[model samples]
Target: MGDNVVVSNMELERLLSMKGGKGEASYANNSQAQAIHAKSMLHLLKEALDGVELHAPNIPFVVVDLGCSCGTNTINVVDVMVEHIIKRYEALGCNPPEFSAFFTDLPSNDFNTLFQLLPPMANYGNSMEECLAANNHRCYFAAGVPGSFYRRLFPARSVDIFHSAFSLHWLSQVPESVEDKRSDAYNKGRVFTHGASEITTNAYKKQFQRDLAGFLNSRSIEMKSKGTMFLVCLGRTSVDPTDQGGAGLLFGTHFQDAWDDLVQEGLISNEKRDDFNIPVYAPSLQDFKEVVEADGSFSINKLEVFKGGSPLVVNQPDDASEVGRALANSCRSVAGVLVDAHIGDKLSEELFLRVEKRAANQGKELLEKLQFFHIVASLSFVL
Candidate 1:
């Protein structure tokens, strides 16, 4: 996956690829849980905003969505945030500051789709008029800032509130040490570190620590004193989620096994299979605590782990095949391009079909057995 990591058509950074287009092909349908979770996490934002001291009345109040894919969940997240802050201002009987919401993601992100969902006249994008109109806030702004969040994307102390959901599991880049030919942690069979040899798992851990250290350090420079960041993503509720059945971590394991089967049948090469690894990691609770404690950048105000339930869609069939197909579509919608980009699209269709078949075979029991655990945390920037 060395050459495969770089897509032939571009040099742009690609994270989890969101489904493209305006209709069924898009991610709008599959992200219902994200929207629900976005709404549910409002209290964290509110509690954090309660601590923000706006020294200058004319300065715009700022909120940024770190990985706002296609803006479906972004709208609700920003909407709820504005409502929360406005209520705080009202509670204090003070004039509210102007609002500015920044929606950021990788360069390859479908920002056009995200822009369509926003107010049209913003040119690049700056306002969600009708939503903010209801509140007493006079001016509301929204914009797409395309870049990797692991680096500096804004000025020092320029940010007030930061929010990210269902993102951050992605590593800035795949760990280079795992691919070493002479290394014991080569990850010869599977594409992830989740139940691999101790060397492999620890190699992945070191990458997360390095990447997360940079993430925290960069944010520390840009965040105002006590400015809070709320992050939620799939993570291990235990020290290791490898033993956790029905956890989202298994999807890669299942897919990698299928890839191996395909390799065995001479459909795909084992070298390509071994070379390709999913560039994501679900940090354990202790992993998160260790990073937060060592970084000296932020204090954890809250951290909670809970299982997320999949909402049944309207007009969707209640059978195993359809259920599995939808799940596959959702998977494809999110990570298909990333997979194809890493290995080329020649085998992608058949690969995901195999995934769909396996999922469908599980039937309604899949629904019963499906368990997605999320870690939501509130962090206050250390001054």
Candidate 2:
């Protein structure tokens, strides 16, 4: 919602990542909100696991967590999946098989931190004696997979269950047309397609369609027949990407003001801000259904849109600025890397500080508007 600025090209993959490590500002600490989303979907996940047909006994039951940013949230989801899977086998009167959990993310992801948080595998080692001694709780071996989910990451029929949370909204890259100066869809001053023009929004939607298709097709090849996939990601309550009430899908006005401040001070050019577009999209339920049906690899078991309120807002902070700062930190955990890559670390830090300050000044009313909508889907490969 600012003046049109010139454009430039920048690679997306090298910059896309969550803030790593266990530091106060890292994704591990800021991801409680994401953890909440995972918790809300547990019932559906358990129901899906109940129907999982156990493979030959004694073979490892493979589970993959796609887009597993460095955090306990990732570990928590894997634990629930593995534990439920084992329970499913037990309910079927079959001995639970060993488990393999693969945590996958971009190469830029901080795998070191993720591994450090993993429970000791000595208790869950391949040996049956160790597994029994540990009371069969720690029966899964963990591995880090550094790559994009849009590309194939596993061998055919290898994975038994796939779980991804708060991840798939990220497109493999921003659409080139939106950044092209000569194109009609050039996004101009906006960093995301929240209330952008119909043309600009359509460009992003097309990119999302391609990205989602690639993701599903890759999993179809890697996952075994009849395997299950559970996904949770940001989505829109409205079909129109131009809708401002699209669950406050991305950063709010405060973030834009921060960038404007930089531009006014001549710290960064307006063109630079224009060039930066976050490679994320929140599609409506209809958008998701169309893509899956067209792909024809998996049948959708359940797909629904649900609202989630942040703990920052839900707990009711007495100081509005406290909630503002908390919300900004959560955003920085995901967007800081990209901002730093585009405008250097010093400026990026200053920008986020400005955002926090502005958001705080705006107070409770503004922060409350930043609601989230989640699309939870359960799908299985066609037999």
Candidate 3:
């Protein structure tokens, strides 16, 4: 286990409370596509499980969905997993073994939103009930165990399969070197660039390596031999050390742009920039492979990228003109801590307005240029 970074529960609660309802709305609105992604993950997990069964036939299975945000999407994943389990059991003509399902995320995730969405087994119709009756394997849901993936959060040899989607790219902490250095070279009047000094970039990468190793080591302890883990996350395609379009470039530059804009407009003080780093880290494929292979716990079974297009714009009515307001709102929750702590309430709004105006003037076409790689990788380890 590692010492988890301490974030005040009260502060996190305030941030979540501010965006809880809106985040729930976003999840509800995006349920369909999210379901599709979850099902795809299930398909990949099942394939891995099939290979595992060739060696260990009688062991029960435990599947965990990490960073399962509040909504039907979580249930959709459970549904798909249960359905697959039933199909597999029937084909084998063997009684299904006990199973445990875990849902995990940041302590600040909208768990209340999740609780409200739990499925009523009685209402799940006949087929699911028959499967449940035959198997006698109960479903369990839990939350708020671990924050950083850098630490062990479960018992050793306990998990059989782990699944996380749209998560795990979050860095444990901000790099110390970039803590307070604000320059137009990095941040320009609310329009930020991801250009970090070489030192800062290296520092961030080292932090990522440390966190990645810890994540895999912890998972190795809990995962049964030959257990499977599937992770789907946002990553960058470019591997170029000099390219500003890399994963580091995207975050550092964008943050700088936003910070600079805010500073020029007197929305934020330069001193606050040190406290304003986004908590997320988008790793490129090469970096991801380097970290995982170094851990020596699991081997890759499959890796692929999806959603090569720009940042997904939700709730925008116009197709050609992106909804800058909606985009800002969507970004606010994930990166809300930055605005609340640094720019404060009044200036954050002013800064967003300026950015939105610029986005509109640019015809929001540039927004369409922003691409994200949805990398899906499956891994399995020998017990």
Candidate 4:
């Protein structure tokens, strides 16, 4: 802005949320990438848990899952983390400490559906006791905590290990300048800063920096000294900002192209298109490290970045129609709600279908343009 002034847009989609509930529609498209990370996450969990030491011995071993949507992926993560922590206690000839896990997300998340998926063993309070009585080695307790992770959610040094995945790329809200008609950064016919001018991109960049700094500051407060955190999420594979390949998924140009067609059809107003910017930032690995090192609250234990390949690319469909359908469903699953709010459901559906056709036609071309960065960072809090 005129003075590096950054404004907030509360109308954001409240995190890169998946569909609510236990149904496949919630995030079936994400299953492949998530499964790939899950296997790797277990090894990270082993390292983090084995090396962890309770600051005050015998206190409840606390864990928090940031952005745990619907408990599908979270249940597995929580179960594995709890089991490993217990194994550490057993190795030391100590009785299993009371374990508590909190799954946090935005207040609007469908926690009811998430709870429905939990077995009686994960019910709060005496549930872990019952599991313990039955000789379940991983006696653990679970609950939901709903809020924006950009702010403080727990007391100082209250958490032992914090975990988040596929969620951190979501900015707390859309950048305000993108919606500011008076600002040169106004993206007159786009929905993100991806292909916009330098001003527009700068706006998104500032917003990301502000939100991430806040997130790290809050976590440093909640995490105890020597506590470890495991984070896995999407990022940029290179310093090149204009990697608008079809594979960019959330950050690609095709998304705006699909929306532009609707504007031509007079279904969506130019003003609305300019006003709606997706609250996401595909940051480079250096971007992440810079923020962490500046905060000085955590030491980087390990960091790795992988190229995220689309299932659409890997599994070539028989025809464009089939490809269109698959890509459309995938887009709808992640972004349907936001589209519905801005342009109404009817238009959003039509728009995504058109996007599908576009993706189908783009074919291997879009696949080649796929540019996504998957980051796994293991951090240790330095009190």
Please report the TM-score between candidate 1 and the true structure: 0.88
Deviation in Å, model 2, residue 258 alpha carbon: 1.4
> Highest lDDT: which candidate?
2
lDDT of 3 by residue, 1-383 (tens): 11122233235423432234434224444344445555555666677656554223355566787767666666666556645665677677665554557777666666776766675433233444464664423343333343545577788988777777766766666544445345322321222224545455555567667877888888999888777877887666655422334333334443356666765666456545544555455666777788788888788888766554444445453543455554444455455544554455566566555545544554455455555566678898765
Q: What TM-score number comes out for model 3?
A: 0.78
Model 3 misplaced regions, further than 4 Å: 1-19, 23-45, 52-60, 122-146, 180-193, 241-256, 314-322
* Per-candidate TM-score against the hidden true structure: 0.88, 0.92, 0.78, 0.86
Best by TM-score: 2
Tens digit per residue, CA lDDT, model 4, 7-102: 235545453466665443355444555655566557766786765665434588899999887746787788888877766665676666687889
lDDT of 3: 0.57
Please report how far candidate 4 places residue 215 from its true position, in Å.
0.7
Judge candidate 3 at residue 375 and give its lDDT: 67
lDDT of every predicted structure (CA atoms): 0.70, 0.79, 0.57, 0.71
| Full-model lDDT, candidate 4 | 0.71
Descending-lDDT candidate ranking: 2, 4, 1, 3
